[model samples]
Target: MPVTLRPLRVAAAQAESVAGDLDANVATAVHLVSAAADWGARVVVLPELFLTGYSPQAWLPELTTTPDDPRLEPLASAARERAVVVVAGAAVRRSGPDGSAQRFTLSLLVVDEAGEVTAPYDKQHLFDTERAFFAPGAQGASIVVDGWELGLGVCYDGCFPEHARAAAEDGARAYLCPSAYVAGSEHRRDLYYAARALDNGIYVVFAGLTGRCGGLDFSGGSAVYDPEGRALGRAGIISPAAVVADLDPVEVARVQAENPIARDRLGSLGGRSRVVVAGPRP
Candidate 1:
């Protein structure tokens, strides 16, 4: 590979969170951020709602936090020190219509290498049982990391082809999904992301949780798929692990050039209203 076109090293962290234990979860996330950074990952992705442990029964208005919350300072410190962007999930508090009240949305937090935290994607599709506890976001979001545009998605959001298609149409090279997939449903998790990647001819990453999370056993099948829908690395099931892969830009371009799906698609569709630039390209 030429120095001008270096591959991006990304990581998916699979870990167990203590239900409703925000402090412990934050600490664990900070540690994982460091681990990924030490392993030379320029971007680190964690499971959805890992900050709050993903328990609907324990849900409270107070569980929702803004990006400036002090509890997330440790994560910021780690990201800044390690110089790696951290993409994780949290229950974000948002103002309601006409300032009526605050609504909690399951959001994907883009913690940049500069320690800037932004909630660009709020998870438009709520999974089974999630509809009862969370509100769907308006649309999709994409972020630019080191010149490569990456689409953001939560667990259930990865199932929709339209969602990934829209992002790819809008110039996303990869989709980063933060999820908490339960046990026994491992097949769905396995199929959804791979299909999405191949369908769009883009990279797809699934970061999953492991062990017991909110009274459910989360299966850790975190993986990274190239444009050919091939797994780049092996991840453990029901074990805390970090799955890492080096994504080559040249390969993505080569595959997209050969694949005609993007050009064959009908009229352009709107996707990813928000565009976040992680930082300057190295």
Candidate 2:
């Protein structure tokens, strides 16, 4: 007889964030985290800029804050009490060097079961409109938990294959995307998300913001996909919801063994594709 490993239960949350309201947004995230935990999720993902709302055109500067801000304590407490990994989004302010202006980054903060907060993983690729208000992050990031390497990506970052590919090369078993995508872009999600999973043979979890926030209407298509690019669960386009799925390492192993794309690429592509070292994790 052999000891078996339990499948990892992950949850993707689709919720609305009120612009410029930190306390309210944190409360919402806490509630969602609790709900996900109650459903036995070991990892819970929220949408992009969920803490301050996805206000790219207005009120960005006012909503930006350092990763250590006390306002985020409630989320940390939730993660600690629930014993789950919470990945939430926010705009992080980083001071520039040598008297340069402060730079704001669209970032994801990872909270572990011990209530520890890791360094922020900023969005490497800024959307067209986002460039005006946010600076692009320098490096990608991933965290290892319960024998799984989970990669982090913001909304626009998922559009670029290299972003997710880099994480896959660095040993990520699953990719988590936090997005604030708008309506009328269903094709984008349908195409790219599946490709990302199929191309790398890694699980992909997407959490999108829903409802109208400010002047933008979000396309709430939160979903989780297996390594074979099969959707395990999905949420609606106009409602606040959550989708959860149990991802088995055995399934990932079976897919990778059958496909071997990542392994075969190493021989044919030479050095064109290389492992990207992610930023430090908690």
Candidate 3:
């Protein structure tokens, strides 16, 4: 039996942030979500730590958030009202009281059209500076939307091909990366994103944070690529705006059939296959 999934209209939100300003940041996310929905988007992706900006450790006292953080309600409310799926980022508080409070860079809110949170996926890989303040998430969690499994990663997670390949192995047909990557070093991130899609034969959806934060400027080259490693569309460097593209799972399957990168093929020699990890650029 041939399986099928609905093609999604997806948009990415790029924003200039005010670090540690939770209220204002949430408001800004709400505004972007509304704008994206207006453009007929069925799903929208926001940058990493969007609700409290990218730098939170320096403002720990001001940048606190619970799983049921009230700050995220507006995004859910807008999703429910607009009948769209919203994926917004935030620094999530992870603790059950007795345990110490650890912050995870979370792709916090995954709101369905019914205006309810269907599922939420946190970032598994914490970047260099992020390791100091954010705790890493375990593997295997993914967001299932309308029969398509969407794998979620933030920032540095995109640099790790294994993370994305694991998602594909777990039945993910698409991967969503919400990032706060800066210029110069962004090419490394971009290539890995492309490699993940090409290697796994899945779609890649990347949303990047723009403008400056903590004295560093973000690259903001948000983009989407097909399974064949072809870029469908890109938001361009340093530009902040929303763009939509159609994702077809059938095409992804076709590409996988043709490329067979992730498939194990039988050989005359038998029981041997080579795989390698491409490292970060200089």
For this target, which candidate reaches the highest lDDT against the unseen true structure?
Answer: 1
TM-score of 3: 0.86
Question: Distance from true position, residue 125, model 1, in Å?
Answer: 0.5
Give the per-residue lDDT of model 1 (tens digit) for 1-282. Answer: 644657899999878887777788889999888988889999999999988887786467787778988888999989999999999888888886887798888998889988999899899999877787789999889998888889999988889899988899999989999998888998888999999999989999889988887778888898999998998884767455788899888888888889868888868677758778697889
Look at candidate 2 and give me any clashing residue pairs.
none
By TM-score, how accurate is candidate 2? 0.89
Predicted structure with the largest TM-score when compared to the true one = 1
TM-score of each: 0.90, 0.89, 0.86
Error of 2 at 16 (Å): 1.0
Better of 1 and 2 by lDDT: 1
Candidate 2 per-residue lDDT, tens place, 68-115, comes to: 789889999999999999998888878768756788888898889998
User: Which regions in candidate 1 have their CA more than 4 angstroms from the true location?
Assistant: 1-5, 96-100, 266-282
lDDT score of residue 184 within candidate 1: 94
Cα deviation of 245, candidate 2, in Å:
0.7
**What would you estimate as the lDDT of candidate 3?**
0.76
lDDT of 3 by residue, 1-282 (tens): 965677877887788777887777777877888888788888898888776778644336347576466666777788888888877677666664778755554545577777666336767776677777666666546787778888888877878878888888899988888888877777676687888899899998888888887677787877888887777877766445876788897888899898997786333556777777786789
Off by over 4 Å in 2: 1-5, 57-59, 96-101, 266-282
Give Cα distance to truth, residue 163, candidate 3, Å.
0.8
